[model samples]
Target: MSPTTTFQDLQAAFPHWTIWRSSADRLWATRNQRLTDAQLSHGLSHTIDADDADQLVAQLRNQEKLATGLLPQ
Candidate 1:
């Protein structure tokens, strides 16, 4: 079965980034109507795996923190 994550879940976790899944079971993220560097480096698509989801969450959180200066550069 394809792994699924709801928009609500991701919205609650990282409201700063847009999140969604592709028809082919790939996860995607974007900020300011553009793909993140991580997304670009990893490719625009990701397999629906728990590890990939976790990493995406982490990257989004970091992006949020960096934007808000919560984390030092």
Candidate 2:
């Protein structure tokens, strides 16, 4: 194919791919929530204090927000 043709094809496909990947990411997140919660809980067990729990939760929330923000818009 011509370079222009390939460029146009990519211009069309890029958004679709972005949407597909985003949906997949969100689906994975939904499916993983319970496992993630359990893992977080298990990890927090080693913390053993209210301050530690708060710190853990805060850090996790910040990380999650950062992760979500990094996803395609």
lDDT against the true structure, each candidate: 0.54, 0.31
Candidate 1 local lDDT, 1-73, one digit each (tens): 1257566788677565567766766566765345456655643322222235766676675555445532223
Winner by TM-score? 1
Q: Model 2: how far is 33 from its true place, Å?
A: 13
> TM-score of the candidate numbered 2?
0.26
Candidate 1 segments exceeding 4 Å error: 1-5, 33-51, 70-73
Worst 10 residues of 2 by lDDT: 24-33
TM-score per candidate, in order? 0.49, 0.26
Give the alpha carbon lDDT tens digit for every residue of 1-73 in model 2. 2334332443253322211113222210121123245445444221211123234334434434544533343
In terms of lDDT, which candidate is strongest?
1
* Clash count for each candidate, listed in order shown: 0, 0
Candidate 2 lDDT score relative to the true structure: 0.31
